[model samples]
Target: MTQQTQEPTTAELSAGYAAGLDPREVAETILTRIAAREPVLNAFYLHDPAQVRTDAAASAARWAAGTQRSAYDGVPVTVKENIPRAGHPVPSGTAIANPPVAATNAPVTDRLLEAGMVILGSTTMPDWGMLSSGVSSLHGVSRNAWDPSLTTGGSSAGAGAAAAAGYGPLHVGTDIGGSIRLPGTWAGLATLKPSAGLVPLHAPYLGRVAGPLTRTIADSAALMSIISRPDARDYSTRPYPQMDWNKRLSSPRGLRVGLQLDAGSGAPVDPEVAAAVQLAAELFAAAGATVVPVAPFMSAAMLTGIDAFWRTRSWADYRALDEAAQASVLPYIARWCSAGKDSDGAATIENYQRFAQLQQVTRQATESLDLVLSPVAPMAAFGAEHPMPSNDPDEPMSHISFTLPYNMSGQPAATVNCGFTTDGRTIGLQVAGRTGADEDVLAACAWFEGVRGDAAPDWSLVP
Candidate 1:
């Protein structure tokens, strides 16, 4: 066929192959898009056009030989910088000179490669995945696709930006606390943070998990099925029953949904954000689901406790660095790390106790509901270079009010674009399910996509 000029979804690319479109040609189109947009978005860290062409050519040969590896065999995909890829340095978005190239691929990377997906490149992230904005001392800032002046939420910053800008149909991101969903919300994309242990972690932490960010919930589900496979290297990965997530999309007719408008942290929520979430709840009701408004069960004290635990964990990482290397980190991250450096065993125990209390409260609140809906972030995308919208210490943590608690509870949570603000900022609706109900969470997201329509930002207007 004629050379393609526009971005195609993962499903569209697969169908094109059946209609005589060459995978190599599709790769060429994607590479061209990356070249044109990378300067504006700064989404990628290490992309090799020649290497991608080589992989795409192999995929074309497989298709011609009727030996395709998977439905997404020829589709382009991007991985977050923190996720290891063989021969690429795991910079974790730092300025360390001559970082060692990874000798092995992360489990999620390996799964994508085995599925015959063409790797577009690795996306940028915050140093040590510590911040909520895209700016990193090593990679600069990853700009929001809708408005470059605004920040792309972190630590999955580049992943969200890339997906929103139509760099590819699928991208993978890691989240300890709202990293994936936050950016997904700000960029007007779909993202999933599966329950802990559902997706294997390269380096295990209390609530860290790797998941997909895509233009649509269907694309996210397709990638999720592949990456969620068991990996021997990650012993924390639990055995998951095989199922077709693509088929799980249906009307949430009888589902019980709880609407939480405010996170109860006294953090201000933009009117547009609240309206978008309420719209989602209204849509669920219109679709015959039972919807009820619920007060935030998570308290400010519980959030502070969780934040302390995260800071302590970040402090451990910072302390492992040499004095000279420590000086290379971003000021905010350094400050964050130092805040917990003096934390003692007593503080750790207290944080854990508070965490348990939050978990217990969350369990009771969500015990009778199929899903809970809230705004992914209290506000939309803010300044691209700032760590947070406000200088107040509590403001940064408060922004994650709706998201961090689920991380503590180890429940599956996702975000989908609901609507855009009056000034053009994107808004997202968060949908979360009980622990071990990742598929259910995904299904709810898909249902919302059906109601809202999976319309991503028009990247052609960018730049």
Candidate 2:
């Protein structure tokens, strides 16, 4: 018999399903949990109880007939609002009235549906997916599952919250900067920002890609196995070969791992966060991996350059909206993007060159190392009401220093809970690998999960 667990991890749920568990029963438990916690977490932007039950009933019938769609056929999953499902509004967490409904499902969503996974609903994000905090104009404030007063982080706010609150085993989120990792870190969830173009996206950009937020690294691998399939919609996708993502993970024996204590820009790492990440590096060393100190390669100039480029991009988006719609935006987001209202073509080009510089410098810095370890963010958590850790429009990107570079350089990065602060804030240890080394990154994180047992957050504090 499969061991009963507190959190319904993907593998455990699969085993239970195979052992005669009904999908309808699992669906009822999830729905009940969501009802109990939704007032405090505000995790879901849309949830249809009737739809969930209907889907589960079909899955239950399939199981009874000795036929199931996949190992995760009956598992419940949540998709971020930005990743569209047919007949749903893609508000992008804005205050705009009557947001446009999506006409089609995104590549990732299609894959999950094809695998017979039940979609719980769309999760929330900050307006225009710009801020790294959870105060959204459209969906209101999404709070941390561990502590409701603390921020959930964003723009993947609700996805992180759902994962932490046990809304389901898998929650899909999109990461351009630290959207996935920041929230995952603050909320004590396992999340990944895959190598750029590794998973096909409908609207692929320079750093944008979709990945999963889950309670365990093994669950993350289970999700990746389905979402990483080929999709012709993404023109920038790399040639990714399918493999057993849930394959056994071994120790980091003989691998050269780099430890980066400073980001060279943004907010300085808090002492508690630093200590937790350092301990994780020590564990790698104890497991036979050669741990070497790597100097900070990202500079203030590089950070500001990317910041300027992003502001310009956001300003364009803001200005395109009609006057009433523009006024409805989150004031912090409005103020931040307003700084780039007068940006010139020359200035925009110069600012965009920063992406190239970041890519070049990051490549040079980690060239000799198989993997790098760092703190996911400067601090553990911030106020749920604040738009960012600094709570200032002009200095918005300061908290994303550690996780942003990996996005630009196209390296796979994962965040797992390593420790907690003195006040009980969750701290995350970041594991990043060389470009195209997604499997290695997952393996290292999975191995760490095994060594760092029982660090799971207390769900009683969620409300």
Candidate 3:
């Protein structure tokens, strides 16, 4: 019967497993879902049915003997392709032939395996993990589970699609400039872009963090509890602090919440998206939280400067590749990175300084507010084939204004489906808190999810 259930949550799976359900049955359910949906979603880069079956059989034996490794010992999970998983090729969304295989697992991968979770293999992403749409150089396009014509936002593209399609209970995604949250929004899933350094990463960078994407906030929290474990490999990680991430949710009463509808520099928020976000703010106000408007912390120069810096960084990597490999990159990414070749040293340094400026302004803007609410993306899902909403390489980052600030500020942010667009695409309400406030942000998201009722689309109906 577990195999017959639709879109089961972690809690549901855990209870089922505890009640003598075979881990293989749950794994069979997941694999069946993947088989039916993957042809349309293109959500995974590497999936081996044999490996899945082998792992599930082992976990089934453990559960039968009452020797499960942990509460989630048999739970199915998927990691984004960029996360190293020893022997797996981390192509990082590029089309390089024979891409380098990871010599060792990423810290998050190690933690997940050590806890006895069954990894479902790596999901797909955009070329070089640069774009916010699902179109990729190597993996083709990953479409939304809600509608194949619409994009599953990226570069956590496939993770979002997989989570929404009920691939499993847990999916690991990396976010820097809204990769995780944007995909979470478009795919109608719960996602957390943890504070920088909160989750140990194999190669940490400014504004980069590994987090979870799932259909429910509690599942995201549960997965976070596992992946956030400290690892010495990440020198940039903060002191490991243990917390019951899946602990009881807290009331938001007396909390000062800021509602930011205007992103300041990106394309204007769609009327429907704006309305959905405003309604979310009103719900918070009604919940005994003081809701106030927060002035936009982003500027045109800041966004453009950061974009330039990223381009330069991308170009640096691209230029190092052989001409054949460079030519294999997505044309849009190739064009975007080529623009970076025009920047001089002085300009590049000046552009990089915008990071500090962004961090300072963001902190100052929300210093008095306990949390900030905004639209995860300015609009709902766009065409699945485009690299961005604009489809313009020169204006690549216009959609990231809302989600990028938190990454620069090193703050915790999350997205939960608030409402739907006129066309029925999902709208995401972003909940962000200052640095070290990840728990608070996640808790608020959990509370909001409770109040939001059952707005998620039924996966069984997807074509």
Q: Cα lDDT of all candidates, in order?
A: 0.84, 0.89, 0.89
Clashes in model 3: which pairs?
Answer: none
Cα RMSD to the true fold for all candidates: 2.6, 2.5, 1.9
In terms of lDDT, model 3 sits at 0.89
How do the residues 1-463 of candidate 2 rate in per-residue lDDT, one tens digit apiece? 1122366788888898899999899999888888888888899999999999999999898888877889898999999999988898999999898899999999999999888889999999999899887888888999888878999999999999999888889999999999999988899888899988888898899999899999888889899988989899989899866656866658888999999999999999999999989988998999999999989988898888788888999999899999999989999999999988767999889889989899888989998999999999999899999998999898748888889899999999999999999999999989999887887888899899888754555544554
Model 3, span 191-290: residue lDDT tens? 9999888899999999999999998889998898888888888999987366668665556789999999998898999999999899889888988999
The TM-score of candidate 2 is: 0.97
Q: After superposition, how far is residue 315 of candidate 2 from its true place, in Å?
A: 0.9
Cα error, residue 236 of model 3, in Å, equals: 0.7
Error of 3 at 49 (Å): 0.5
| Candidate 1 lDDT, 354-388, residue by residue in tens | 77787678778888999999999889889998876
In model 3, the runs with Cα more than 4 Å from the true position are 1-5, 454-460
